[model samples]
Target: MKLYIAEKPSLGRAIAAALPKPHRNCKTHIELGNGDVVSWCIGHILAQADPEDYDATLKKWRMESLPIVPEQWQLKPISRTRSQLTVLRKLVKQADEIIHAGDPDREGQLLVDEVIDYFNISKKKKSTIKRLLISDLNLPAVQRALKSLKPNSDFMPLSISALARSRADWLYGINLTRAYTLQGQKTGYNSVLSVGRVQTPLLGLVVRREQEIAKFNSKAFYQVQAHLSLQVNEAVSFTAKWQPSDNCQPYCDEEGRVLVRALAENVVKRIDNQPATVSKLESNEKQQAAPLPFNLSQLQISAAKQFSMNAKLVLDVCQTLYERHKLITYPRSDCRYLPKEQLKQARGIVNTLAKSSLPCNKPAQGANTSLVSKAWNDKKITAHHAIIPTEKSPENISLNTFEKNIYLMIVRQYLVQFYPAYIYQQTKISLLIAGGNFVSQAKIEKQQGWQVLFPKSKKTQAADEQEQTLPPLTKGQILHCQQGELLEKHTSPPQSFTDATLLAAMTGISRYVSDPAIKKVLKDTDGLGTDATRAGIIDLLFKRGFLQRHGKAITATEVGIALINALPEMATLPDMTAQWEATLTAISEKNASYLSFMQPLTKTVTEMVYSASQQSFAGLPKVAFKPKRGKGNFKKKTAKKPAKKSG
Candidate 1:
């Protein structure tokens, strides 16, 4: 009998629907008419055994057992899904042919492959196994995937990369968490001091930003604006900002802002009512193609900024749109470009959107289906394509506010692919007035094009004031400076981290690194964590009390600050994470071996354990532990009043 093991039940049902019909749904497996059966794992059926599981002595936290490295790793069935695993074990023994169906990503590949390894199948049987990769649950997409099955062995390197990541995380997170928690206890703080490869560095970013904000000293700066009238049209006048000359360096800051009030006042007096000549006038037409479709991180960042939604909430909404409604493709995809073949479905999808009740339905009618954007490129496609809307209409689908909003976002972004590029003319005017240079610039929109779909918000409309149109002027044309105005401004401190900015920082972490080589690697690898895990890692920090949210701003807690101050620089910086990610990418591409990566990692972990042991935690703050409430106890508890003073 042919057997298919899927990553999850929803995916199993999707695969079953694409296969030969006359399906019989059993308690654990779905049987097809042609003697084929399909079963699924509930996420991951197996997980790496914990440290205590390896040895009883390691169960208790002690400094002596600092670095516990397992010689022979073990996998234990998760208790919640043990029954489904049992069914799979029995089915694996009876199957004559097997097909491995998992999400086409690293974690997905490892989850399914590990299950097959647990079955202890013969090498001959393993070589015969086929792999099915499905990104979209739509029946048509699934059917297409079914016809293009490849050997499961072709993805062994991907599985191995995931395995290395898992073990590395274990060795790093587990050992450091235990070591730090022990250190915290020494300082009379009883709570667990959690440390992670990604989360700790993320916390460090917040703490450092807070420090920078606290230490910043506001400085006053001055500027001179020239109110000028064109000689050709006396009624047409515009304001130009004064650009300091090279000789003005002594009186200005490094950013070219005038620092001395006297210097700015002198420029204003010198340029007042002066006859100005237009020195240079340049105009250029520019076209901006619509942005590429949503990758998980990009979607999360947008949702956070537009709707004040957190990363975790956005991820959850995307999953619902992808899995339950089947209205979108995979939610965890990292690629923002679609395969060129996806362009063939553009007309059908646009038609469906136009007929739906979505917010973009009216705008969808204006989409030029024949106009292909640069977003369609086969070379840029990763494990899965961008998150885009399926051809399925949402007319009859019941959606809550969040789901509808997220679905609309996905549809709108996809619809933009069929729209024309936004066209505008950028004009720059440079003028000379009394030996000082003044400049004015404007962006005149020639065609709304794709921008017609997005109406400007109040903030955007306010920004447009700076780009007002300019009258016709030519170089060497004389103009009159009506007056000069001196404006004083002060430098502002950096803004606190918000959900949107934090996610953006995590996505483009390279900007924060000082080393050019490391920065380039981070840019190439796409930030600190994968799209599938970033939200979870951020959520985990909140659960561990490492991060707290106030309105839309996220801040580290006192304990969080203390822990960051106590750890070594390597533990708190993103440099190490960037290096590991680059190596993992190499492993996935089969350019690097697992041992070559793990050996250095193990040595690093050993050094970290020793380093952590030597660090003093005396300055760490003590934390009050909260007792766990029993189930069904929903009542709030009030603290008892302190007794009268014993004196």
Candidate 2:
């Protein structure tokens, strides 16, 4: 019998549909369709043996067995899916040959490789093993993949990388969780002080941001604006470029302060509706390259930015779209582009999407061949090109609000790449008003390009309702000052971290570090977490009650903030994780040793544990909150408290 191993049951059924058979109706069992047998793993079918699995006494949850590093690891069927394992073992045991049809990536490779290891399939010499690779799950794609297969040995290196990641997460998660939970118990808290390499750093970010929020001191600042005649440059001029006596050194970060101190009555310049001279008009016409296709992280970021959905929520929606609807590609990928060959079918998928709530217009002309040189490298691609719509139009796939939002995002991003570069004329015109240099700029949209299909990009900053930019104008051209005012404002502190920005920070957090040279080196490296796990990392924070979302805003909980404050200075910072990712990526690419990269990190974690435990976190320290009354809040309580009711 020919046996096929699929990553999940739904996927297994999809594969089974394409196979020649008596059409074995897939249930929760491995069954034969005369010529073949198929069974699938929902998730990790087998997990590494816990300390308790190694020694029965360890099951009691005592702290004595500090570092439970097993010399030889053991695997046991995950409790929830033991039945699937039973069916799988029976099939693999009886089969004459087997096909490994796991997803074609590190995690998928690990999932199947470990399943085989758990069953000790190698010990049984009769089953000839060959692996199947499928990039998309449509029937034709599945049939094509079924005809050709490679030896499982070809995926050994990726499997090794996945194993390393899993083991490292286990080692770190197990040890640190126990260490902290035990410590939390000692500290009079009944809750487990949960921690992980990814979780801790993630929680630390929210907590620290909250702390910054708590510590922020509001100060009055202003910008000196001169309301001039319909002269465009003069009406919008800011005082920063105007030097006092042309000899005074400018403020480091106090340009706003200087403006605030200046009297509003001070009229720096006054002019009538004079013909403004065209001093310097520079226009640059550049094509906006199409956005790269949807990688998991990019999808999450865009969804969060556009629809206010969480990363995990986006992933869940995409997963449903990918697996259930079978209308899209894989949901867990980190690339956002399709292959050269996929371009033909991509247009068809875009056309099929005409039935959606947010349908695609006709595929843009030259979208296929106009891929910017920087985005067309085949080497950057691996198992998949990017997330895109499949040629198949799904039927009756009902999606919830979140799912619909994510689906829209994927469809939009995929379709946009084929649209023409957003050709525009960018003009920057400078004007020398009376005594100071003033600048004015505008974007003339010569062509809407692919942007015509995109909904307006959402933002949390001031509601810039103006979606269009003006055409070219001479520096001296006088435009009507329909509305002009010296808007008194404060020097606003940096906005608190949102999940989208937080993910970006984790990817290239070295930018926040103080050391110039090291920061630059770190800048060149990929961020702390991979696209696959970044959402999960954030979810872990929420699961542990380390982070909370208030409406669209993210804040750290008390336990999370305490963890941040209690850490030994290094681990709590963003740059540390950036460095860690840089090193890990090097290790993954074979440019560095994991042991060498992690030595210092291990020491840092150790030091943090000791320091956190030793600290006299005697009382739940009162968290100080400084709330600013936003020129509002104070209102007349017209209705009294019902005259104290019954008093």
Candidate 3:
């Protein structure tokens, strides 16, 4: 009997549907006509064993057991999924051959591989194991994957990389959390002071930004504008900003903003009613291709900005769209480029979109299938492709408001791949008036092209109002400066972190690092965390009372600030995540050894635990403890006595 073990039930059903007919669906396994059976795991049937599971002495959090290092790691079946795991164990023993079906990523590869390892089958049976990788649940995509099975041994490195990440996080998170929680107890703070490999650094980002905003000092600056007109046609006029020369450096700030009002006033007086000659003029036409399709991070940022939805909510919605509705491809992919072969399905997907009643249907109908964008490149493809709409028609499907909106967004982005590039002309003119230089620039939209698919919002329309349209002119042409105006402005402080900006910061964390070498590594990696885990990390911080939100702005609380101040600089910075990610990538590529990564990590953890022990968490604020309610804690409510005489 051939046994297929899938990552989840929905995927198991997808695989079952593609096999020979006469399917018999049981509670946990599906039986096909040809003596083939399919079973599944509920997410991950096994989890990493806790520190206490290794030894009874480690059960209690103590200062002596500062860094709890497990000599040999172990896996325990998660209680909730124990039944599903039991079914798989029995099936593995009975099967002649096993096909490992998991999501095509590092975590997914480890999820099933660990399960097979738990069975401890014969070496010969292990050698015969096959692997099935599926990124899309659509019928055609699933059928295509069925024909391209590969040996499971080929992905052992990926599984090892994931295992290293798991053990590293466990070693880092468990030991540090216990060490810090005990320290907080010393300060009379009666709560668990949690720290993570990724969450602490993320919280540090917020606290640092808040401090920067508080310390900012607004400064006043002045500018001079020349209202000029064509010499022949005085009716046609435009405003040009004055550019200060090197001689004016003493009166200007480092950014060249005029610090002294007198300097701006002098420029105004000198240029008023002067003959301004155009010293240089340049025009260039440019074309911009449509942006690539949504990766998980990009989609989360967009949803946060457009709908005021949090990162967790966006991920949940994407999962439903991918799994339940089967309307889109995998939602956890980090890659934004599609496989070149997927281009063949463009016409069918576009046609499906046109038949639907979506807001983007009209634009989808007009897509030119013959025009291919740069988004389709086989070289750029990673473990999985970009998140895109499936060819399945949604005309008869029932979708909620959030689902419909997210689906439309994905569809519109995919349709744009077939649209023409946005074309525009950029014009710049440099003028000399009374020994001072002035400049004017404008962007004229020559063709809306792909931009026509996205309607501008009110904020975008307001920005468009500032765009200027310069008249045709030649170099050395004379113009008259009707008058000069002096304007004063104040430099504003940096804005607080919002959901959108926070996600963007996490995605592009390289911008915040000071070390050049680490910054380059982070740029090449997937920022602070994987696309599948970033939302969960952010959500975890809020649950721990380290972060709070006021309206749309996110801020660190007093406890959060104190925690950051107490921790070591290495614990609160993003530099460590960069280094780990680089090494993890090498491990997957077989260029680095797992022992090399883990030994140093273990040494680092030991050092940090010792360092934390010596430091006093004196200023840490006391967290209010909320007792968990149990059956015995419940109190029945009594009916209030009638007070009817209140006339």
Candidate 4:
């Protein structure tokens, strides 16, 4: 008997529907008409045992019990999901062959692999295990993947990498969190002070940004503007910014701000009503290609920017579209490009979506498929292709506003791939007045192209006010300066991070690092977390009370700031964690042994334990928070009230 095990029940149903002879019914396990059984795991049925599970005495937090590393790792079935485990064990015992139908990623590989290992331990003989890799849950995709099952041993490397990561996280998070929480107790701070490999560095980013903003002192500056009228055309008047003299270097900064008010006033007076001659004229036509399709991170960033939706909300919406409706491909992918061979499939998707009543009008109207985009390349494909709408039409499906918005975004990005590029003309004019040079720039849109589908808002239009149409003009033409004003402005501090900017920072953090080698390592490796887990990491920080969200902006709380200050740099810097990710990648590729990675991890934990022992929390501020444990287990000492003197 052939048994199929999927990652989730929804995927199991999809697979069962696609199998030959159809499925009679799907309940605990789908019994197909062809005598095959299909089942699924809700998620992980087994997890690595907690530290306390290793030894009952380790339940109480203690400094001496630091560096807790399990010698022989054990897996225990989750109490709430044990019934599913029982069902899976019963089916695995009767099966002659098993197909591992999980997501094509490291975590997915581990989720199903762990279950097989758990059930096969008691059996006298192991069933043949095979892997089914598919990008989407569509009927055709599922059938194709079923026909091309590979040996489960082919994915052992990825499963090993996932296992190593899980163990390492256990070693670092469980041990260090206990050590730090105990240290916080020394200062009367009654919080858990939770820490992780990625969570701490993410919090450090927010805390450092807040510190910089708090310490910033706004400085006043001034600039001169010339509102000039062209001699050739009366309707072609424009504003040109004044350039400071070379001798007035103190007034000019890198941002072109004139700090000295008196110098700026003198320049305004000197250039007032001055006759300016156009010394240089330059014009060039520029073309901008359509935006690439949505990766998980890019979708999160765009949703945050456009609709003020947070990262977690965006992921939830996309997941529904992918898993529930089956209207889109995988939502957890990191690649933003399609396979070159998928161009034909994309054309069919565009045609089917054009007839659907989706929220985005562009896909419904039609896409120009005469030209292909550079985004269709084979080498750019990673674990999965970009997030995109499937060939399925959503005409009869009911969708909420959030689902509609995200689905439209995916559809529009796909439709734009077939449209022509946006074309515009850039005009740059240089003016000579006094002893300095002034410049004016403008952009004229020649064709809306793919941008007709996504229109710019009023705020974006106002931001591009400088990009106005210019009349034809020749060089050396004298223009009349109508008026001049010295505008005073203060340098603004960096804005507090919003979900939009924070997501970008997490993905592109290598730009901020100073060390070249570490920066390259971080770039080559996925930043802080994978596209699939970054949102969860951010959510974890909020749930732990390490971060507070005010409107769209995120800030580190006092406890969070204190936690970073308390931990060593090696524990909080992203580069160090990124290096660990690089090592894990090497392990996955079989280029490095697991021992090489674990040895350094052991040394790092030992050093952190020593560091926690020597930390002095004398001046640390008391933060009001309770550790997430049983209330009566550990109590903060309360000072006794002073005795009355008049008694």
Candidate 5:
């Protein structure tokens, strides 16, 4: 008997429908007719036990229990998700072959493996048992996976690492929450004291930025603009926008504007005019090749920017599209590129999409075979390739406005890759006035390239303007500006982080790190978190009250500020995470030992936890979960007492 264990009920249903002799048996749990019993996990059906789960005595928050460390991690079915657990437990005992049909990602791997280990499923041997892994839940994809069932042992290490992370987080979350909440109660407040493996670092990021803003010292600077005139066919003439000397900032204040006017009024500003010669005029054609595919992070960022969809929402939508609708490939991926072997099949998938019932433009050229970079290596691809649409275009699956937009974003990007590159011409013009120089430039596309799919982005500025080329000017051609206009402008403050910018910043934090090795490691790894969970991390911060959301901007609360300020060190932020991810990547690439890779992290986080506990708990305004309010204003934060030194 071949039993397929899906990640969710909808996926199990889809798998049953895909089978040849599919049947629905709902005696105790849903069983597939193909002699396969398919069951699933609604979410983390099982998880590391909390202290409350261990004993009632441990339930009460206490400080004497400083660090509640569990010698061996325990797993229990999640409370609300128990029904799914019942289904999963029943099928595991009876199935000869258990195919793991979870989403192919770290979290998914852990979810399935944890269940197997908890239920004491014997490791699948080569002859009798099997595990199925696939990114796409379509009929053909599932069939192919079924034909090639892998031994469960192949994914053992990944399962172990994932398990370790989950347990460690549970330990920190439960122990710390208890420790602080109890402390808060003693201090006269009952707010939840939130802490976690990834949440604290995220809170620190917001706090650090706030500090920089508060401590910033404002600076002033200047610019000048000249208003001039030219007779018809008489050549344009105007004062230079730049200051004559390099000693001062090039801005026009009230006095600077007057000086420019006096100089132009007197005609003495005709000090010097030197024509700027074009050193070289070169044009080269380049290809705008298709990208690999969308990973969770990249897709979420794109969706958020394009449709203003939140990260978690996007991930959930993509998951539905993949598992329920069976119309997209894996949604959680770190790779944006596809392997060469996938190229042929990718082309087939694109061609099929062209004819499929789904609303999409047929991608021309074999889109799959279109991967052109070293990034498309099969060796680097794991549980999934990248997020792409499946060949199967299932009918009328309803989606919300945001989900529809996100789905379109992925489909459109896929179609774009198969299209041609955007070809354009760039021109630069330089003028010399009063011996100073100024430059202007414009770019016009010859073709829209892959951008043609999205009409909004396809239109070039030149399309609305004139197709007529600029008047030809040779080297030594002295062309005067007919007019120069200057409008007074205030210096703009640094813009707050947006979804797109934040994702970009998160992925590129290694540049800010000082250590060369650390920087390089961070470079090789994604910034701090995986594309699958980065948004969730941010969301957790908001839920825990460490970060308060105001419109689109996220700011740290006073309590959040105090926590970071009290931290022993700042190494837990994105920079450090990037460095750790780098080492893990090395392990994946077989260039580093898992032990060496983990030792530093063990040392780092352990010290952070210790430092947190050793410090005096005095002075902290008990955990204040409620946002105190004053009439027409927020209440002031209570002053803190002096903290005792860590003993």
Candidate 6:
């Protein structure tokens, strides 16, 4: 029998649906009429063995066992998943050939590969294996993928990269965590100082941003505003902001901010009654195309901004849309561009959505299919395309509010591709007053095009440019200045990280780095973590008590802040992730070996152990988990009166 193993039951069922009539034999396994069996894993059936599994002495936390590097790695099936493991082991023993139908990523490759290797080791027999790399779980895509299954050995490099990453994380995380936790314990602080390759740097980002916000000092600045009435239309009035010249040293800055009180007052007095003339008036037509489709990070950011949702919730909702309802394409994608070949299917999807009623708080709008934008370029597509609705409609399916909201987001992104580009006319007006240049700008909506689809958040002149209509005027035209006033404003510090901004920071972290090489590598690679794993990484941080959420903003906890500060600079910096990503990429490309990557990581782990052992933790903030007590058994020490010390 040909056995098929998938990443999860949903995908396994989808695969079976694509094959001939499949009979459900058990909840965890299925049988096809053509002598084939299908099975799945919830996630990872096996995990790397912990240190205690290797040696009983290693079970206890001790400084002597600081850097635990196993001579040979081991794996054990997770207790909760042992039943499924048993089913897979039995299937492997009876099958003549095996098919791996995991997701199309490194982690997915490793998931099925590990299961196969474990069963092979147990049954003492090697089965012929083939890989089914399916991007979409829909029947057509699955059928196409089945016809082009590649030899499982062809993906050994991906498996190697995944294994290298796992071992590296274990080696560094175990050793560094023990070293730092022991150091904190020596200082009378009893807490686990958890550290991770990706989590620590993410925590460092939050801590550093908080530090900057805390230390920032606000400075007062002054601006002069004038309300000018046009002579052409007496009823038409507009506002212009004053721009100071470069010669106004010590009194004003290049941004036209008057720093000195006297200087600001003088400028206000000089320009109050001065005659103003229109120096320049320029109007140009502009066009803005529809935004690209939703990548996982982009979708998370948008959902967070629009509905105050968290990253993990958004992923879960999108997963439901993909796995349960089959309403959208794959959600764990990072690419924002769709393949050109998919344009044919995209048209069908648009037609399907046009006939369905998309639920919203208000009335629903129909989808327009007049034009398809450049988002369908094949050259830009990566392993998977953007998240869009499948060529199926959700007409009769019942959905909760959360699911409806997310489904609408995906649907809108797809419908936008068929709408015309947003068009507008931009106007820039410059005025001369008291030998200083004042500028005003406005935008006129020439065509509502794409904005029609997004009426609630439509872009208008006031919303986008913050300028009202300016009456018809020509150069050298005079205008009446109603009044000039000094506006006192203070600079504001950076806002805390909301899910929207934090997701942006994670995907664009390389922008903050000063090193060109590392930045380039990070730019080429997806930032910090892949779309499939970033949410889990963030969820882990919250579970570990390293981060807390206020409203929609995330802040590092005291323990989290302290942990980042205690770790070495190398561990907290994002360059470590970038470097590892580069090495992992090379290994997958067959340019580097797993040993080559692991050797350096092992050396670094050893060095970190030694360095952390020498570092002292004196004077570090000590937070007690228990209530504070007075000197002796809840009694305070009496203050001794100074005894006649005057002499």
Please list the C-alpha lDDT of all candidates, in the order they appear.
0.85, 0.63, 0.85, 0.79, 0.60, 0.77
Ranking by TM-score: 1, 3, 4, 6, 2, 5
**Off by more than 4 A, model 1:** 232-236, 624-647
lDDT tens digits, residues 109-197, model 4? 88998999886544434435888877777887677678878887778887887787887787778777777768777887765666787
* RMSD each, Å: 5.3, 9.3, 6.7, 6.1, 6.5, 8.2
Give the range where candidate 6 is weakest over 10 consecutive residues by summed lDDT. 638-647
The parts of candidate 3 lying over 4 Å away from their true place are: 246-256, 589-593, 623-647
Q: Tell me the TM-score of each prediction against the true structure.
A: 0.93, 0.80, 0.92, 0.87, 0.78, 0.85
lDDT of 3 by residue, 615-635 (tens): 788887654332234221223
- Specify the highest-TM-score model's number: 1
Instruction: Give the 10-residue window scoring lowest on summed lDDT in candidate 5.
Output: 638-647
Q: Which 10-residue window of candidate 2 scores lowest in summed lDDT?
A: 638-647
Clashes, model 3? 0
User: lDDT of candidate 4 vs native?
Assistant: 0.79
The number of clashing residue pairs in each candidate reads: 0, 8, 0, 0, 11, 0
For model 5 the local lDDT of residue 198 reads 60
Task: Superpose all Cα atoms of candidate 1 onto the true structure and report the RMSD in Å to 1 decimal.
Answer: 5.3
Q: What is the lDDT of candidate 1?
A: 0.85
Tens-place lDDT digits, model 5, residues 1-647: 66776676666666676675647656334655556666777767876666665666665555665465665557778788887677667677767777777766767777877776677866452234456777777777766666776776676555655554555456555555545445544555445556555666656666777777777664443344443223334544433344444432243444443234443333233423323333333344445555545777778777768777677788888877876676788888877766555555566667766665556644433243453444457777766677777776534567667666777777766666566666777765555555544544455668776666656543554565633334455656545344444433444455555666566666666754556766765563457666766888777665545667566666787777766654445433556656655555554445556567555655555555555556544555654543433222333332132111100
Better of 1 and 2 by TM-score: 1
Q: Is candidate 2 or candidate 6 better by lDDT?
A: 6
State how far residue 23 of model 1 sits from its true place (Å).
Answer: 2.0
Descending-lDDT candidate ranking: 3, 1, 4, 6, 2, 5
**Model 2 clashing residue pairs (backbone):** 276-476, 277-476, 293-336, 294-336, 337-385, 337-386, 367-418, 507-527
